[model samples]
Target: MLNYWIGMAAICAFAMAGVLAAGRRGMDIIALLFMGVITAVGGGTLRDLLLGVPVFWMIDFNYVWVASAASLAAFALARHLRDETVWAAILYLDAFGIALFGVQSIDKALAHGFAAPVAIVMATITGIGGGLIRDVLAQRENLLSSREIYATTIITGGMLYTFLLAQGGASHGASLCGVAFTFAFRGLAIHFGWQMPKWLTLRH
Candidate 1:
């Protein structure tokens, strides 16, 4: 139940971020909404498939409705938000969404009795999967190809959450902290132009 609500919130945040991000490119309302929905559910859908659970949207139509509604709302309000710093807003929202999904994914996996390592990997995927799909569909370079500190932040947050769980911390509070930490790290990276060490980056 907790995971469900967190997932919905993450979907809404990313959907709004998608519209804001694409709107800055002068995309039409329809295009913006399409991108939003993809950004909202791409990650969780993948996570469910991998876990062999019923696709969430299949069992719960509410996820679809919420994602679609958020997308439309973003589209309708895009012009009003046009003057806002779209990129920065999207980055921050993306960071939050990533953190939320990462923690939820790990918690869900552990609930299902998965091994810790697998849970960590699933959490990482849940963090980045939606954004990857959003970028690809929008014809932009995925974050994985950039020098950004995206995946690193996700991994760090997931590890932190897993450690807390192993230490018998309350799952909800630890997850919240993990999400905050990931968002802070990612937001700071964007603000400070932080990048992975050159040796760790691809030489191209």
Candidate 2:
């Protein structure tokens, strides 16, 4: 139940962030809606498909409507904001959405009897798959292609969540800690322009 609501919240954040990204490209409202819906559901869709489960939005239909509504609302409000503000909001919203989706996906996988490694991988897909698609559609540089500590934070948090659960920590406490650490880590990276260590990145 809590996980369900957390998924919905992630959908809302991702949808709005998608709309802003598409709108920045001067896309039409229809295009904006398409991007929003895709970004909101893309990650979970991939995770479910890989997990051999029914796609969540298909099961709940409410997810689609919520993403659509949030996208349109964001589109309407974004027109009044500056580009700098829009980008900042997108980063923060994306960070928040990633934090929730990362832990939620891990929890889902664990519940499905997957091992820690598989659950961590699924969590990564759920945390960034949408943003990856959105960036491609928006013609923006994908975060994974950069040296930023983006996906690293998601993976780190997923590992922590799995470790805590394995150690018999309370699920609720583990989830909160995972989400908090992911969000704060990503938030700090965004604020401080932190980059991955040179050895951890690639060079042409």
Q: What's the TM-score of each model vs. the native? A: 0.83, 0.89
Q: In model 2, which regions exceed 4 Å deviation?
A: 1-6, 24-26, 83-90
Instruction: Tell me the tens digit of each residue's lDDT in model 2 across 1-204.
Output: 876776677688788877876666557888888889988998889999999998988999999999999888888878654377666766787788799889888988888998999999998998778878988988888878878798899999998988999899999999999999999999999999999989866668
| lDDT (0 to 1) per candidate | 0.79, 0.85
lDDT of 1 by residue, 1-204 (tens): 875676677677788876665555567777777788777777778888999888777888887788888888877776665554764665676677788778878878888999888888888777777778888877788879888788899898888888888899997788778988888998899898899889997688
**Model 1 alpha-carbon drift over 4 Å, by segment:** 1-7, 22-30, 85-90
lDDT of 2: 0.85
Model 1 lDDT-worst window of ten: 79-88
